[model samples]
Target: MLSQVIRYDGSMTSPSESAPLDGDELETWSALATVLEWLPPVLDVQLQDGWNLTHFEFGVLYALATAEGRSLPMSTLAGFANSTLSRLSRAVVRLEKRDWVRRSTDPEDRRVTIAWLTDSGAEVVASAAPAHADLVRRLVFDSLSAEQAMTLREISRSIAAAISDEGGWRPGR
Candidate 1:
């Protein structure tokens, strides 16, 4: 349970006042929240407009394109893409329709299915990489000072670690 009070001033009482975000902390949290809300769709639009792919689909294809022999077991690929098997299955089906990827039974494990990037898929990913990279650089890196960039990386890693520890949501696991 939690509680707060607002006095005559237009300020929020911190939760129980035992712990509270100070002004700077509140500002930082708000900024992070805004970025989290806005960044994904911006990213998805760039991929969709320029490459005819959603970010998740591109991510799946990109993962396969970078894997050994341009292939991975479906389960492994889902983990790498940070997606559920069902969602990854849907994305793979769309990619297969585009001839960008193909599915096969793993030779060493008949029970396992593998996703492989087709030649056309590899070509598409290669072509899309530059534009996507440029957009990311512009939106994220271009605004940061070197020190800020390093701080952002460190902060992100720390947050990811905390999430993994608390929620058991490690990617590529």
Candidate 2:
């Protein structure tokens, strides 16, 4: 059963005990929400301006580039890219038009479709990687001490796991 939303004064109650967020909790959550809304466009702008690739396109290519045999089944690639299969297919089609990726069926299991990064695709990813890394470092890591970076890694992984567990999401499902 779900609890009813309760409002006291101008503030809504928290899920538990109809408690409102205290000042510190409210500030932390607001900051996180702002970052979530702001970061994706910043990343997209950098990638789009430099490489003409949306972050999603770059992610798909990057995943294939780092994979063994430079290939994965379309379903697996979609999962790795955090995209639905239909969206991945459309992106793959665009990449195919650019001669960056190729698609084929698995010989042993014809029902399965696979995607492979072409030599050209490998070249593109290789060329784009340094710039991407630089931007990521500048935007994300430049301000952090090594200790803070490690702490962030631990915190982010815990949060991600919690969200995934609650949503029943598996990266390669």
Candidate 3:
């Protein structure tokens, strides 16, 4: 069923067209697909259990924490987080409710909004980072040989580059 150039009814497909995987290709794809399905939820569970943060919320905070002046424009943050503005805004509202983050109109551009991390937010990230990092190491790094880690980084980046410009929802405000 996972073939090209041959349909289930025994008709032929275009030879130049891509077909579904079979044999070793299918096995490799299945393994990669499993990892893709499993990793995010596992990470979310860890963050939610340990820090009361979803993986996405943590990613947003972590991005702000590393940004200069602990602030980034909301739109830019949304891009960096690979999130829709609506989702980022909702998360910002939650973060604001916690007093961990605050928003301000950009001084140079009134139309632009900036998300600023409060001292409390910085402190929270500082407290949470070690545990999160330890979990990452235990789950990912500790299991890989140095070569495999390098290969993984390379393969992942390559795959990302291959699809980075492909079609996807590009939500705007």
lDDT of 3 at 49: 89
Where's the lowest-lDDT run of ten residues in candidate 3?
164-173
Per-residue alpha-carbon lDDT of candidate 2 for residues 6-96, written as tens digits (9 for 90 to 100): 4422345447764677799899989878988988898889888987888889999999999999999999998888888888999999999
Better of 2 and 3 by lDDT: 2
**What value of lDDT does candidate 1 attain over all alpha carbons?**
0.88
Clash pairs (backbone) in predicted model 3: none
The count of backbone overlaps in candidate 1 is 0
**The 10-residue segment with the lowest total lDDT in model 2:** 5-14
lDDT of 1 by residue, 1-173 (tens): 54666543344676666666779989999999999999999999999998899999988988988898999999999888887888889899999999999999988889999999999999999999989999899999999998999999999999878766655554433
Best by lDDT: 1
**TM-score versus the correct structure, for each prediction:** 0.85, 0.85, 0.86
Residue 68 alpha-carbon offset, candidate 2, angstroms: 1.0
Q: Every model's Cα RMSD, please?
A: 6.6, 5.3, 5.4
Q: 1 or 2: which has the higher TM-score?
A: 2
Model 2 residue 63 lDDT?
99
Once fitted onto the true fold, the runs of candidate 1 whose alpha carbons sit more than 4 angstroms away are 1-22, 168-173
